[model samples]
Target: MNRHLDTFADSIIAGKRLSEGEAAELSATSGTDAFALFLAASRIKEHFLGTGIDLCSIINAKSGRCPENCAFCAQSAHHATDSPVYPLVDEERIVACAKEAEAAGSHCYGIVTSGTTIRKGEELDRICRAVRRIRETTSIAPSCSLGIIDQETAVTLREAGVETYHHNLETARSFFPSICTTHDYEDDVETVRVAKRAGLTVCCGGIFGLGETAAQRIELAMTLRDLDVDSIPLNFLNPIEGTRLARADLITPLECLKTIALFRLILPEKKIAVCGGRERNLRDLQSWIFFAGASGTMIGNYLTTTGRPAEDDWQMLKDLELTAGSCRE
Candidate 1:
């Protein structure tokens, strides 16, 4: 099995795309096999993305009152939660956070909002102004997660100097109905398409541990591979109190590592970042993400949950002898 893993890594380095059966086989690795899997993933990561890690930070520009009920989300209005509720933050506040993120050594800074979609007149204009300012004042690339956006909105953001548009499919198309009923899976897929069509790089991915099966996890990865997204942000589930999955079991740290490795093997050349749930889910194994094939991670607080201090992440990178690479690199 270890030799096979090495061969798989070699094939990936030679530009072979893993088939569903091959990815499923890799997903079932355990014990010693899992260690070999991580090593293989690490080799693949180095070959494609180099040893340097990319760091990204996000500001929740707007919060709560989202109509869509993603089972893992804390900000959805469909479930009562302690998450903050606020309007789109002012342009100055948004740009300020971007500056802070850049100073913290983040390569990409995202301005995220909670809603079905961003309003066009005032809200969109404000975010566009903020993106323009971020481009002018900071070296960090600005991205936006303003919910389901159209081609017009995507182009408008790109024109304002937004480098990437983020929209997660949330889960596998087959399992999406179990997590979010108000919105169809195709809507999220379309958002990725719209962003790509409008000349924006799409950062698309899904959250795991939503009662999805291993097969379903592979399904989501294959879907993203087909979409040909520029980057994939892999989030683990951090069950929030008022959400539907509050009682959901936390996937083991090894499982989280395996998932990261699986994504790296499947999406070999793409920028795969372990975002959100890293601290809570990975626990003691938090530093193993890169070893398990992740090329980057989100360094600051998540949408509603607080991440560990950025200094801690910086120190971890130092301990690993890794440097944070620019997203544009």
Candidate 2:
């Protein structure tokens, strides 16, 4: 293990945040030094967040026909992918999905849609109704990933029973232009800011393995740290068949674990939920996410993708002796 890695980890453990330079150094580490980094991150996670895992699930409330030309997205209209395309489901169906997530022991249920922006209209009304239904009937907290949002819409979602508003940066500012062109990177940042200002806990994170360098990953984390987001969902790229990133190779499991540890080191106390692409990317090393210092993870289906079964995930938690939920079930 490198001396600087230990020193930086010790600094984080002793209540000091990692500087951009130190974070870059950590991202540059590989092999055993990186494994040591994971250990140190696990310690920081246990010290700050305890061993309880915050489990969340999401339903693609609406699908496909998106105008955004994001290279990694299968739902974009510019792509020739076979991703499911449909209008937003009615409130009853949304409620049913929320209830299912709750029953599977998920602490949060997010309603995600495929679009550039989830504006105010009938779609908004239906989402509000679904949120209300979930709040009235289930213990699971309601959340949304309704694209770029204004402060007014953020407040409206809050009043509609949304506890968190998820708007992923998707990648670092420097790398974003290569990945998506329809929306500006600053728009994502502003959405998170507005969501936070409107009294919603911001769940902001980015996808990895989109041809970004390790330093770029750290850059995204720094941006998230600055945003003071409440939850961070670390999604690995899944390379849908028709997207521009379809031929992009998958990141190694070890690298993914290291990335999760880096996220823990960067945002020591924030909820780090390992979401989309875990199944293929993590493979046999999936449970290593907990060991690498993730505070939570998504369990069940994903937007345009299937995830590991809830039962398998539950058993993995049991095998690892880690409690599930935002705290405990």
Candidate models: Cα lDDT each: 0.93, 0.90
Q: What does candidate 2's lDDT look like per residue over 39-99, in tens digits?
A: 8888888988888989998999899999999999989999998999999998889999998
Task: Give candidate 1's whole-model lDDT.
Answer: 0.93
Top-TM-score structure, candidate number: 1
Which stretches of model 1 miss by more than 4 angstroms? none
Compute the lDDT of residue 280 as modeled in candidate 2.
Answer: 96
Compose the digit string of candidate 1's lDDT tens values, residues 23-132.
Answer: 98888899899999999999999999898899999999999999998888889999899999998889999999999999999989999999989999999999999888
Report the Cα lDDT for residue 90, model 1: 93
Q: Model 2: what TM-score?
A: 0.97
